[model samples]
Target: MRSKYTSFTLSIALAWGVWGCAPSTGTPHPPAAVAPSVPTSAATPAASPVTSDTEAGREPPPAEGGPLPSAERAGGHEPPPSRFPEQRITLMAVGDIMVHDEQLEAARLPDGSNYDFAPFFNQVAPIFQEADWLIGNLETTLAGAELKYTGYPMFNSPDSLADTLKQLGFTALTTANNHSLDRREAGVLRTIEALDRAGIQHTGTFRDEASRNQPLLLTKDGFTLALIAYTYGTNGIPIPKGKPYLVNLIDPALIKADIARAREAGVDLVAVALHFGNEYQRQPSAAQREIAGLCIQYGADLVLGAHPHVVQPYEWKTVTLESGMSHNGLIAYSLGNFISAQRRDYKDVGVILKLTLHKGENGEASFEEAEWIPTYVHYYRKNGKRQYVIYPVSLTLAAVQQGQKDPALTKEVLNTLHRLEKEMKLHLDSLQKQEKAS
Candidate 1:
């Protein structure tokens, strides 16, 4: 019989195609440095640089100190000094935030007027707070109690979920997914409203056509980012007639246009969040790869994917556009479930993907580094009350190895933690090696 650790290694090797064998020895690396400062609650709209293709051909404004020296002319004007101060911003993204029936029941209060999800994220809150921007995929609707809160095929979670996320330092959320319209048009609108009230920025779904037309632009530490989100489909629910802008649907043409708009707006970075691929699968499907490549070619600097419910591999690619301009982009196929009731092999495993964007003194922005922290959802019962908690797999493994006793650390949970720590170390090490080779 195959050991669980062997099975775990094989599963990751199959999905990633990079890990040749498990590490022979060595303690797992510690987590990366936490973010330094808290980001603003909301990003202001940046001034547009170019309005249309006609204006796109115009030259950019001269530098503060003037033009650079001419190589042909001897003793021409000297190069100008760098004006903008160097800045770095950290962004963290996680996968599906699903609310199942059991989760809702656990959060229910005695009077039933409200739900408290604050406890669910207690362990992970500090990690998230370290990031300049923490983003996630909200896989359920917050359509209020009028819709009779439920879960599963059609999920309508309490608005308190959004509130709890905001309180825990969630900078933004991706609102496009199969369950975007679970409660129909009303649900879609209500979800946006709830997020707005909680002061959390979101994209992929809109309350009006005008809002949909605008890109979700965020500014932090002198860097501006344009975030766009799209889903493959809405679980076969027909979008209301004459309201095609309710939810963003995956289309190359539409995606290209949005990327162009972001460029015209002069945003420093363009990040695309996609809800695609087969559920429970650990590998990126053909469609997922093709679409991700297309987005990079269209001018996206990074692509964050979800909806697989299972963690997948990530890679960095350099894409050359039709105009002969080449750009480097990062593609993370899937992130799995951040927190949920699922107990399947990889279903409970997730990652907090972190990337640092550095803006040079000359106003040029690029990705400086990338890393991920593996996480696991721990479910346990205490005092006759069920609880769902998230734990960083590496830390949990360290604790277990030390023979510490804790109510939440059961034998099965410890096994899962060990498997996760090994798999994550191997996966991340492989990625680092590939990056160095490239």
Candidate 2:
């Protein structure tokens, strides 16, 4: 998967950690020496350079067992003031980050081993740097060299992907996708250890009983946020004879129970990351809609989805809590592939959905507003020596809404995202129409 930046202040991180008492053990390492941006094949001369070395395949020093650096240690440039209002908690969520074979091969160092990914993330780090928190789906196993790494059918990515993720501003990552157990049981343990060492947090797959029972909690901007992750299946991989707890599955009864615990703990917000839906499908399935509705009813405030390997529509959903209280939530049905080798249509385009929650003067917290950034991942020159570099489309909706010099290419990307969005809209509309008729 590709890396991007997200920024926040160190003081804020310290304040949150002390106040919330959530262990901040695995924070990402600071960014490294300066570098130049690798201009994309399709990039205009005016496009900003992608400067971070992580994107360029440089590795950062290990961040394990040291006194954590100040919040500035969190890599990436701070977000603009306008992006985050005062006294609010903002979260940015992205889709699947699949580390295919090509990525690993490119990441290999001179020692004939995989290099760490933290450095490469420094390039696009600014995008996520500003949010109070960031989330993404890790669609590969961290099984290390003991197991071979491959793409498509099964994936065992470099363990260093966790370090890259932490540096890129991800507080929590979901591991409950179809490829969750690509290397079997060993991959699960190694992945968790890698994340733990980097001080990054994770949910979904677990190596043991303790990891399985742990609920990832992050306190940001005076709000306590809880994250829970689950997937529909494990690419048909058996969950080790009697180990149903190895990975979380989307079970309604279990989800309701989990939400109940979060609410009882008085978490300010509850976010559910679901690895569901069909591969490359533009819209959510009936099962996805039903499960999302169930999450809302059970007290989840935001729902992020994945496993489509392509972009899906986003919706602003509101539901009444069991206490007869109304609340707003964002259901990003699917975020598509953040960075991958996939050349399929909307599969190359994804959305970074940002949500903010604020505590009003009256001591009440409410959902504020939401924004979506449309991104495209244009593969670098696949023909020859420059095959390793992949340029994630950085243009905004405003930029793409206008026609491009290459109308055909622009049309292809936008049309794919738009069609997916339309599919999501149609599903919602059908539900609304049925309600009216009833």
Candidate 3:
């Protein structure tokens, strides 16, 4: 398949206060609250020169000793140092990780315990582990093994899934999806508990008021990012009496309100992870575009979506924040399935989107670049049991290159991506206009 955003460059920079902040679990504990703020040096928005291999789909070279790009100077437009600490952060986001009954059985270990999913996820571990921050969607509930772990109908996954995800460097998980309440209240509570125990942060669903309003804070490379998540509904699950706030639903009012609260909390970057749209359909529905535009109009810095179970085109757009500052943000309408039991043509593959944040010498934050890495979920049928596994495929690798030589698989994957791009091109151009106007 062809590479997306090949012109973008990925780099790691730690600009003074922008370099090393810890990922916060609940409410943010700002640096000033813990220790005295250090005087920071001016930052530069330098990125390494792009190479052919990176554009060809090979992994970008390591950042060590790589030259940093020079900061953009307006000659006289520089502003005063930003009061909020400027940070250069790198984030890696994947799509849905749905655990079906078949894959759960494959996770069965030798001892009496259930499945150990470490091996199945070994392939993409490096990519996740390598990034300063990793994010993805969890489509199944972690309500324990005694509960039947079915696939499509309703899912109650093993809590072990949380442990496996954390060990693989998944810092945050979006609990918002159509299956958020597969087992109703039990499913929601169990999933939260399991993620808590694993030390993995989660959002989109909560057990109480405190959890519901909790802000997911992560410090990577030097930037502090606040992530908020919401889903369309909980499989038609009614909001329990007196607990309407237990789960995040797809209400524009709710989303805008939550975003306002997050920004007030002093979050430098705000990311909204939304789960919407029909399954397996390549293009985003009209409803998807409308809602996404509204989100950008609000205070959202970036929006990542899932629940479509197929790769969707991403657009870099310019949005005005509540602060009245206009800046560019990346939005992936849907990432499809990072790993699942679905076995079909387009449903089998996923994309890995890499994002880098930068700060100029003026100390203002901006999105530097983004790149999409194509990946696939391999299926194996053995011992009369079918299992699903995830694999990260580089776009320009020899195997992928050779696979592209095949007219069938290559044509299908490339065609779907092209269609997605075509649908979003106008939106991207509109975003550029907004940026220029600002």
Candidate 4:
């Protein structure tokens, strides 16, 4: 298969605040798509380099070879200089993790009883590990092997996928998507069990009402963040009777309530992962813009969206809350497919969205910086065997431009890379024009 490389300018910005939170359970319902008037902009600004003192929450480095100072020195009362404490955390998010039949077959082990997906992610593991928390959309169900492995129309993947994700340093996953109910209630329950076993936190779907009632809370570097996920609908599959809480749906009221709950819980940041958008479309639909604005209005600090199966533009908005307070937030309409079998233009490309967050001495959390690295999924055969790997697009392009050949890359891949690079340049130019006009 051919591939493409693209280039786009990254924006950098100063600090920003967090959002509110709340929780609620509900049945699956389709949200009407409404086109909202909004302007498209480049991705959020790149994160500033975290200073050593801020990152380690420590005072300035002491003089080399010098003894550390103490409160009491030489039998006299000597107080150390006072300094405010600060901490920094980095978060990375990606698009859908879809395991199609081709992927499942590629992962089959020699024993035939299991599959190993670890190899597929090895190339990108270092990038993922660079962030303090790595998050992604789990678009397939790990309902166990008893139900048989399938893909596409309905997905039921082996539990090994979850195991691989956990080993790759994924801190959490958003399980709300069109395929969440492909295996029915049993599938949902088993998926949750598998995630729990892997020690990865998840949101959007739950095995029980009680679990659904609670928010997914994560604490790191003196900052508390709450994540909530919701999907447009469950692909026409009715949620189990009286168990509307099984999968989160796109409902503005419920989402706002969840945000309130997160705030009430004293979370420093609230992020909403929304699985709603037109599939295979490079541009976000009207409904996406509407809901994104609503999310910001309801106190969401960051909105990460998915399900378009293709990367979409990013927008930054300054919203005014009910109390007349203004907040700056970001929205990534669609992250696209992180990994998949689809070969359509843009379908095989995605991005790793990274954000830097800082907590000040006053106990306030804010967004420090935001940026993304484009990625491409490479499918090739090696040693008479099939292999699937993801590569950073920029690196791949650089090697090709240098006339270096990779065994895993093909002529088609080079052509696709060039095409993507051209397209991205045009897209960025368009955004710049729009910004100038605004």
Indicate the residue-level lDDT of 321 in model 1. 59
lDDT-sorted candidate list, best first: 4, 1, 3, 2
Would you list the C-alpha lDDT of every candidate in the order shown?
0.76, 0.64, 0.66, 0.76
What residue runs in model 1 are displaced by over 4 Å at the alpha carbon? 1-81, 399-405, 427-438
RMSD of each candidate relative to the true structure: 12.1, 15.1, 11.1, 8.3
Arrange candidates by TM-score, descending.
4, 1, 3, 2
Error of 3 at 23 (Å): 30
lDDT of 1: 0.76
Candidate achieving higher lDDT, 1 or 2: 1
Q: Candidate 4 regions off by >4 Å?
A: 1-11, 14-84, 398-405, 425-436
TM-scores of the models, in the order given: 0.80, 0.70, 0.73, 0.82
Clashes of 2: 23
Better of 3 and 4 by TM-score: 4
lDDT of 3: 0.66
Best by TM-score: 4
In model 2, state the lDDT of residue 58. 42
Error of 3 at 38 (Å): 33
The per-prediction tally of clashing pairs is 0, 23, 7, 24
Per-residue CA lDDT of candidate 1, range 349-368, in tens?
Answer: 88888775665455666554
- Tens-place lDDT digits, model 2, residues 1-438: 112221111111111111111223422111121112222212222221224436534443337976433433676443333432336667888889887666665566658756654433432466676678988999888788768767777988766777778777888888888887888888888888888887878898887767666677888766788899999888788889888778999899988888777766777778899988887877678888888878877778679999887776654455555555554455778877777767755666666766555553333354444445545554443334223322234333334546444322455555654554444334323433454466
lDDT of 2: 0.64
lDDT for 349 in candidate 4 is 85
Question: What ranges in model 3 sit over 4 Å off?
Answer: 1-87, 110-112, 319-325, 382-387, 399-438
